[model samples]
Target: MSKKTEFQALDLISAYSEKKKNPSHLELNQIFPNPTQPRLIGREDTADLVPSMERLGLIEPILVRKDKGKYLIVAGERRYRAAIKLGWKEIPAIVTDANEDVCYEMSLAENEKRKNLNPWEVGKAIQYLRKEKRKTAEEVSELLGYSGRYVKQLSSIARLDQKSVMELMISGKPLSVKNLEELLKRKENRGGETISPRPGSGSGRISINLSKLNGRVRDNFLKELGLLKKKYGINE
Candidate 1:
């Protein structure tokens, strides 16, 4: 289909712009999480999409709203990031009349339509919604089409330190959610202590569980993993 025709068919923007009858394109200044959004744009994905936009122009316009004179992107963060990376001066965008709540819901819906999130990412997103958006775990569960227990699981995954999470994501290895849960349980058992091994617990068999290690421990684990791969000449 033609690009303009495709843009016209995107009912989300058209429905919102129908009243104004004169929606204008705007630059993306702010990006906000869509509560109902599902898709996530990783670095590699951005690289691919940016080149595509440079070649074809943006087939779909992003949705946004005016916020204190700056445009806040309610949907299409991936597209925005791609445009910025491609050095596009102006992007086709549809101004939406959707309220904050509606925008958030639409964004979340858009994101969720993609493939499922990894356990760790899901955990982070759910926790962000609960903490930043002030939504209850139950509320997030309902909105995200996840069970309350599942939402809690995601929150638990988010609690792991950043270094550990990134290592898992980059390793391209499948992590055992059960193992992670056990690790979380162990960390909790330490009475809210940090994710690191306790100091001076010397020779006490520090009971290292593969799951709960984050930050430095996670880094160390990756290093050790590399050594093991070299030592054993393992290839997968």
Candidate 2:
């Protein structure tokens, strides 16, 4: 929920908007996960979701694609996992004929909507699209609702390694995007003697993500925090 970059969202995979098909009860054994799932970079804990599912029973159906007589999860792997853990033999799903590319986009969009994806994980995915020229700068800008320059700036972070991404994921922490970007910039321009955004580094700064909050709520929260910071003589 890192505030959606403000894209006019389209149902790329039609998972949410597909009106032609009703949810089908698919056997848990039949669905396999998409191997290239971007989530593989920083798999999240679906433990919290499990209890909710157990109590309420899946509130939303998962999205899946049928391929080669097997169902591949386009998104909602977390829901599927919870269902598995609950010992359910079958789960409800909306089956779509999304191909590999559409599946990837839908997975990214769904995870993003959940606000669970690490910023770096998103950067890597953007970089992958750019490197392959599958998406141009304009297309990316339109898709993300970010300016071309900003998208390029964000994508530059993909140069960072998976270790850092994993560390953030493990700690459930968000780092200052600007700080990380500046560090990367310096690394490229000035073969920095020591480049680290982890605690040991002097430049390290933690960030609070407000994307999941409603816009007005996040604004009010930030305003209150600013007042508190001023009252406490806190420095940026």
TM-score leader: 2
Which lDDT values do the candidates have, in the order given?
Answer: 0.60, 0.70
In the range 107-149, model 2's lDDT, one tens digit per residue, is 7777767765665667777886677647887787777666665
Which portions of model 1 show Cα errors greater than 4 Å? 1-23, 28-45, 175-236
Q: What is the lDDT of candidate 1?
A: 0.60
Predicted candidate 1 versus true structure: per-residue lDDT over 50-134, tens digit per residue: 7788899887777776666567776677788788788766777777767776566565554444433456665666676777789
TM-scores of the candidates are 0.59, 0.69
Find the 10 residues in a row with the least total lDDT in model 2.
190-199
Question: How many backbone overlaps does candidate 1 show?
Answer: 15
True-vs-predicted CA distance for residue 160, candidate 2, Å: 1.4
Best by lDDT: 2
